[model samples]
Target chain A: MDIVVCIKQVPDTSEVSIDPETNTLVREGVPSIINPYDENAIEVGLQLKEEHGGTVTALSMGPPQAEEALRQALAMGCDEAILISDRAFAGSDTLATSYVLAEAIRKVDSYDLIICGKQAFDGDTAQVGPGIAEQLGIPQATYAVDVKVDENRIAVKRLLAGSFETIEMKLPALITADKHMNVPRHAGLRGVMAARKKEIPTWTLEDIEADPEKCGLSGSPTTVVEIFPPQRSHKTERLEGEAQQVARQLVEKLREAQLL
Target chain B: MNIYIDAEKCTGCQLCVKACPYSAIQMAEGLATITEACTLCGGCVSVCPVDAIIWEAPAVEEVDTSDYQGVWVIGEVGEDGLAGVTWELLGKGRELAEDLNTELSLVVLGDEAGELAQKAAQSGPDRVFYAEDPALACYRTGTYTDVISGLINKHKPEIVLFGATEQGRDLAPRIAVRIKTGLTADCTGLEIDPEERLLVQTRPAFGGNIMARIITRNHRPQMATVRPRVMQRLQSQPEHGAEIVEVPVSFNETSIMTRIIDIAHDEAAGQVNLQDAEIIVSGGRGLKKPENFAIIRELADALGAVVGASRPTVDDGWIAPYHQVGQTGSTVQPRLYIACGISGAVQHLAGMSGADCIVAINSDPAAPIFEVAHYGIVGDVFEVVPALTEIVREELGSG
Candidate 1:
């Protein structure tokens, strides 16, 4: 029951800024961190590894600095780590990204379960997980809040719009995790010390035997043409009066807004 | 263009056919098939429950590219002045126009929306097209689309941009369907390829994990909708010079179905203005109990901000759905976001991670929320939140 957890290093969006002049996000000084959602996937993978007595590998695709995310995963108890980095991978959209990731997963073919966070924080597009599933021609259960591994199958509780659906899928399936899945464990001093000595394998498109056309920006179907900050024009109507009066004013305002 | 359908993956959802609205998709042998009538709007590409449909326009072999003209932004003005999103679109329009070495224009609708037209002029657009009429006062999807589609037909703008607001969201899709064009929604980024003269529309897809880029390769007007507060608004300068061409429009009452019964002014919802709130204090399932939500309310009140919740908290009836933030909930961009006892799940993060600053307070140091938070405090939020609230209150009082 080898498990593969896919993680990404994203610009801490909170620290991300739009250069007013360029009208694009300023990624220069912003620190990078493991995508919040991926952390849960890593935790789940490590826990499953502990219980199942199998190897857990943390895999990521990004620039060189992405190694930090892999290291973090190793510190959190993943048995191994792999970083798929290359210049051509830059500017890849979800479509191309999934293609490359799927190729990388194929390179690590022995894994029985592949876990991913439901989505990444910076882009907030949940497309890649399913996109990878599509490219790999595998079944996927997204938004999994709970997962249990069986002898040859996996049962998962999927979060839907207003309800939960339990699904059973075969091994070697893809599962994108929701935050409710589990609380990720912290890397303690002992784990941190052990992580420093762990070896992280790096792979490029060629190393993974990926087709150059299908692994980078060229493989991407979409492109970005422009970006600008959203405009906000809100006229604040401050309410000031006695409690009952303020409540009355509030109700009147709600009525006007057609919400009441 | 070549259409690819993975029949093995197709669930025969018919969402693509229903969304077509153009009668382009038909059921053939228990599978959805694209007919010759298809205009390649790509609406079905995203709506598919399973990743079954794949449509690709043939690579531009013979590129005329000459007939496609300027970039036009559909300017919107509510009962007030120009909508904030319209100005943002103008700013983006300017960029796309420059990339293509073409001119930028604004199409304004509504009676006396000329003030906004003049404002659009200051954003450095080359021209302004005005269509003023009483019927255009309230947003009617059919009427507004009719007016804009008419103008688009008359002047073939190569690229068109719209704000992904409630109105823009409703209007753009309908107009795209009617005009047989492609429309992408909630784009976070955009770029233009100088060589191809194509507008690259990038947006978060699949909830918010990956950025998906969509392009209207063969469509006349490459249309995209940008979310509000995701773009910068240009400053209005009265002195900026521009020319406005007024177009006549006759609206028949039969075309409009929905009517504004009444425009009541509500204070409670309007006062919070969560969309624009600089500070947001949100609670989630970890709040322990529903009654403890008062702590979140207290903190939000102290900071003169809005209170938000996660889907689980809202599902538990601790708060309303409107207050929930996630993939299915509202996408917010605040200056500061404080999560009290929240576990920082991906769904909740999808909604609020766009904030400038995030502070996560949870008893578990291993909570996923801390991974994205700029400031993290590992402790019981029940104890930490009250103290933080008191400090904020004191600071506000002192100021």
Candidate 2:
């Protein structure tokens, strides 16, 4: 029942803002938290640990500041936390990312299950979970809403088009959990106190024996050719009137625009 | 890789023919012959008693794949038929096809693709391909990808586009993995670079703080999934049609790992149908609390529009996840969009900026939402919302 949860520190997507003049993210003041989905992944791991009596270890890759996110996982009942961070891991796409994360999981070797959030809020790419699964050569179910574990098999209810499908796969498979699978438990004060005493380990690409060729932007297959602001037309026509009249004006405007 | 039949030892039980998911095997004179439609999925090789069928998984590097030309859209057929995104892709695909000076093909994979494919051919594609069967009637990642990727491998299309729906998001990455190609997800803009003949995929990054323009360097048939409603559909010309190529389907049950045990749709909850809505009235954090969502819904009903929520509102549990409109939720490009109490974050605006007209109602004079809005009203929601609702109720009642 040993489990590994992959977590990430992401900027609060809600607070993230673009600087209109520079056309860049105003990253300085925005708070970073554990990715919302990854928090659910941690919850799934802790719940599994509570039910099956196994340790839940959190794994993440980011700069040193990301250890704060790992500490948050520690506060939520993870037994151990590992952070893989170095300048080499910067600018990695999903392909290179899953490679590094999979290598970290392989180093942990004793795990029987791996869980991840369906997607990162910032990146919004749901590929990394399945990508890690494919890299590890195991069956995977993505967008899982509910899961039940048996000795050798696990049944998952995965969300799909207009419906959810239940799937069964052998143990040692990966699942990318969708939100609302369960309401994550709040970390108790006791857990928070214990987290300060826990030692969080840091791993480097060399420690994981990762191919330098495959660890970063250099090893990545896809590249971001350019980044720019999407063109927007802010030419707003103002219509102000009394409250009751405003709605009528709106309807009339819709008619005038041939949109009614 | 090649798939062929050794008809010499073949017993014409038609087992191999029945097992071929792509209907690539045909019985000729009591012996099975592999057709050009074979996707080399090895669906038939296991079923052959006489060892008559053989398939080799292609070494992606060995295949020239250069012969693959044309921009193809994977037609997503809904329960009834013809999802709007198909026509939208057709509209965009037409331009890409013209730029490449190649043909445009669309593959319709569904439970009943014949009708769907015919419907698609009328959209003015050069060729319309269909692979349909009861196994593929609803989308199983295994079944749909088996049939669709098979067609892609056989045809080597230069570029492929998919609607970033639930099915498309689920299926696209798997196909990209299987076919050994790169996929760009949630692309808002697509264009063919005539110089090198690359598909330029533009999508937001860091919650729309920046938009990344991406291109797959070596992959043949660059794949991308665009959110539905982001592009305009081509005008339907029932009088026009294209060449329809029907690919036969015979799927084996064992190859599929998952089954539809039960279907639980949120439709009973009557969530907002933002994906197809012509108009969307969305609320942001400025609505103040979950109970205030009723105001947004009231306005939506007045205009026969759907209720949409910015990511913050949905994150606050003010509305169901389905009502969310942003990078994390559904991207909607309606005919008209109205925002209330929304500050217009880059991510929030990215989703609905494609609307023909945008109206923003926020008290903050400098709210970013004002930038993209075609109309603006700086006022208090408490006053403005109730007034708008009464007006809508009276106006619609009179109409």
DockQ for the candidates, in order: 0.03, 0.19
Give model 2's docking category.
Answer: incorrect
Alpha carbon deviation, residue A217, candidate 2 (Å): 3.1
Scored by lDDT, model 1 comes in at 0.70
Candidate 1, residues A42-117, lDDT tens digits: the string is 8888877777788998899876667889999999888889998876665565656777888899988588888988
DockQ of candidate 1 (2 decimals): 0.03
Q: How many backbone collisions does model 1 have?
A: 40
Candidate 2 — which residues are off by over 4 angstroms? A20-23, A86-88, A110-112, A159-165, A203-215, B1-67, B236-241, B246-250, B284-294, B310-330, B343-354
lDDT for position A64 in model 1: 66
Residue pair clashes in candidate 2: A234-B371, A236-B374, B111-B137
Q: Taking chain A by itself, what TM-score does each prediction score?
A: 0.93, 0.92
